[model samples]
Target: MCRWLAYSGSPILLEELLYRPSPSLIDQSLHAQMGAEATNGDGFGVGWYGLDTTMRDMPDTRGPDVPVLFRGVEPAWNDQNLRELARSTSSGLFFAHLRASTGSPVQQTNCHPFRHDRWLWMHNGLIRDFALLKRDLALAVDPALYPSIEGSTDSEVMFHLALTFGLTDDPVAAVERMVGFVEATGRRHGVEHPVQMTVATSDGERLWSFRYSSEHQSRTLYVSAAISTLRNLYPDNPAFVGLSDETRVVVSEPVGSFAGAWQPFPESSYGIVQPGDDVIGDFRPREP
Candidate 1:
């Protein structure tokens, strides 16, 4: 349904991830190599967090820093402003997505990389029979938090549902609850295999990426090799020369063709990434 990428680590210009690579997110928007469809041109969006600028003396304890967002109704490949912003902006953590609408309107509001407070979320798969399940899922959302939802897409509702299930306290558990709830609701309504997703969500400091579906057959999701391993593999390759040890990228497809630079995530799995090491392990649905 879409293609997306999430990057976390030392600060770097958005162009370094969205444009510089051979099969960058921009290129994937137009010629996706692993997605079911070759083109995802309905719309796109990006969300990133700037460095902590609060004065030390002030000691701001507000939750995680909220991210800056830029979404558009145009294809990422041709959005001049997206390119300009990518070339000029930088962040330690960011999410970028290109959409191929299934049923939602092709408007800015329906773009990926939906945000709430300090969290950013994007999805690349559909919730089977979402139309039958949306009302139940939406009703489960915290009424106090429901008013903040501004769009009419399953992905956005999914994000808020996770929040209602306690995403801020524990993302993995929250998503499990979300998927369980969706699947249960689907069966209750006679819809089979209720969910399919390869989703990424971040709270500015840490990123959680999941690959899961009711059938145990989800979309493609991959993670980059350790920067140190890549540097050793291609000592002379400029692409690996400047990357930091903390650099980590999770994508719907590999950004390049290098053999050891990327690895496929096992089916029914999820990964968590932070400033240092990253972790990957199995994923499975739980009771709602």
Candidate 2:
């Protein structure tokens, strides 16, 4: 498994989100409390929106206003270059991920938080029988989108499969089809439980997260309590007071044990976070 976090709301320094908190994402890279693996050292990546361009290199320069992706085929904690990038960048919406290859190559292209134009995605679980599922899944991606599938991980393939199933028009529906296809394909190959995922994606604005598995035992997924709720719970906590009501974070696990700071995803559910209200509801896979 892997560890990842998605942040939306008041502009925050990447350093603060990745390093300042107790058991921060960087810390999780070495001592994850909830992931299947204690250390996710295969690789790492980050995608952030609206950051100073002069401070870092970018994969897609859609400009300073657009999201930029930075991936490294090295442990997050061991990369001083990543530390410099994190400290110098700031974004209102950003995702950071630590990877533990579940049969994928340990190259930059295989890192998490994969990007496709304005959309970014990362996953914390696997397609149970990926070697059997990959070919069928790859064939299902839109032909026009097929050439753009640059990585070999099931996570990246899921993103493209979602895109093929109409992600731009309806993310939830597309993911439904994607998971459905994975399950259906796996069953044909004699795999008992084909899906196991805690996936997150963003389109430089709103955020979407899903936690589900064909067998109903998905990996850990959590969303932060509303910033307002945190303020009331910990009146003296500066972290709570400094956040905007719009600030929200969804992670593989809570960064800290702060009271009223995290909420677990309901079994087999999905959540959407935007500028207004956030939502969580039952999730069901559908045919593509």
Tens digit per residue, CA lDDT, model 2, 1-288: 999999999888899879888879999999998889999999999998884746557454465555688999889999998999888888889999999999988998899888887899999889887887788889888999999888889998999999999888899999999999888899999999988899999888799999998989889998898887888888887877767899999999989768678889999999999877788888999887
TM-score of each: 0.94, 0.95
Q: Which residue segments of model 2 deviate by more than 4 Å?
A: 53-65
- Number of backbone collisions per candidate, in order? 0, 0
Give the clashing pairs for model 2. Answer: none
| Whole-model Cα lDDT of every candidate shown, in order | 0.88, 0.88
Candidate 2, position 127, lDDT: 87
Model 1 TM-score, 2 decimals? 0.94
lDDT, candidate 2, at 259: 66
Q: Candidate 1, residues 88-181: lDDT per residue as tens digits?
A: 8888899999999888899988898998889899999888778888888899999998997888888998899899998999999899888888
- Highest TM-score: give the candidate number: 2
Report the C-alpha displacement of residue 79, candidate 1, in angstroms: 0.6
